[model samples]
Target: MKTAKLDKLREQIAAIKAEIVSVERAQLTTPEIEARVDGFIQEMKRTVANDVLDSAGTLTYINQLGSGAGNWPVVGSWMHARPAIGFAMAVTLNPEAFRAMVLEAALKELNGGRQEHATGRVELVEQLRGKLRLLEQDEEAEVLRLEENGIDALRRADADPAVVLGLAA
Candidate 1:
């Protein structure tokens, strides 16, 4: 009976060790998470390109437009490196809760911009505003449901030397 109990205890310990390894493997490293965030930015760029193409109708037309004077948000550079990684981690940890929080923050920034009229970039501004309106309409509940966690993530990311130095490769 004594021998059987010891063997069973060892088996349980081995099982617990295996579970620990699994959990560790499941977690993403900071670099990996940052890469994912960069990937998301690339997708945003593609979407922005499509929107611009749609608005201008043709590549020739777009080329003729030249650089617009209005402060249009760059699609890829919308989020700085550190905050993007932090938000990415927050969303990864609790996607359902944090996605809305991230969206709320983005929409707030987009809406906070001063209105511009009769500018070369008016089309771009209007397009972004329309998308923001759609996002606002789709959000189900109040913004920042997990405010504490999001803030903590941002703080941690801000403190990270690599993130601060913009070396997040």
Candidate 2:
């Protein structure tokens, strides 16, 4: 009786192992995961490209600050009193850090001493920072995954992981 029960348990364990393997096989294949990662990377690259364009535009505006073309009557006075306006603007135009600071300051002023408004602004800033950090972390993780999994799996799947990853051979 004891021997029969042990054999039955062993068989059940083997069956469970087989089921686990089947489930894993049913999950996303290496190629699928690589494609997803590549998509994410491309999306992030586009976002960064857009940010660069915005930063370039900001730089152009700063360059024209003292050109005496804008409608600001203070332009002449600003040019005389503060010749370093371009430098100041450059320091403040950082989209990630400086823009966050500006947003926080604007939120504070707009809140007008409301505690709930201040809290909401703080939450918004924290959320934005968290999202940016997650994107960087995800990219790092995907790169590491590709390196660890090796290109052999991709070849077996008949897909070029490098091309999918947008990496030049």
Candidate 3:
């Protein structure tokens, strides 16, 4: 069972690597590329949840959680459920498995740091929103600063002569 799950996870890892390489062959805008990468991350999470989880008895209960059958949206819906229940499952039942899964995921994303486009998963998940909000605020602040300082700074720097010449260089 362990070997089978590991093999399946490795196969998913290979698919993600191929996805990253395929993205490079395209001439997509940055946002478009980011969106595709985001899709890959979601797929990775889904792969871990679906493939690596579930042993016989646990599968029965997950089903008993009111799924009436077995599978996701249904199981997930029933688990709308106590957050602690999910947390306990993650910690007790499948912690090491998912740790390995996510580690492989991140290593694949970095491609040993050769891939410039990869963002850490935490950044992809959480910090990205914060980064984006901060960037928006920076842009608004910069526009105001540019209005206040733009002309005088340009004039002063231009009078220095070296600034303009350095820019041309």
What TM-score does candidate 3 get on C-alpha atoms?
A: 0.22
lDDT of 3 at 27: 42
Off by over 4 Å in 2: 3-10, 21-28, 62-169
Cα lDDT, all candidates:
0.39, 0.43, 0.44
lDDT of 3: 0.44
Sort all candidates by TM-score, best to worst. 1, 2, 3
Q: Give candidate 1's error at residue 17 in angstroms.
A: 5.1
| Structure candidate 1, residue pairs in collision | none
- Measured with C-alpha atoms, the lDDT of residue 160 in candidate 1 is 28
lDDT measured at residue 22 in model 2 versus the true structure, 0 to 100:
42
Descending-lDDT candidate ranking: 3, 2, 1
lDDT of 3 by residue, 1-169 (tens): 1234334433443454455455444343444455665565555556446644543345555444533343444446435754444554554455556555655555555443333334443344344344433433333343345556542211221122332233321
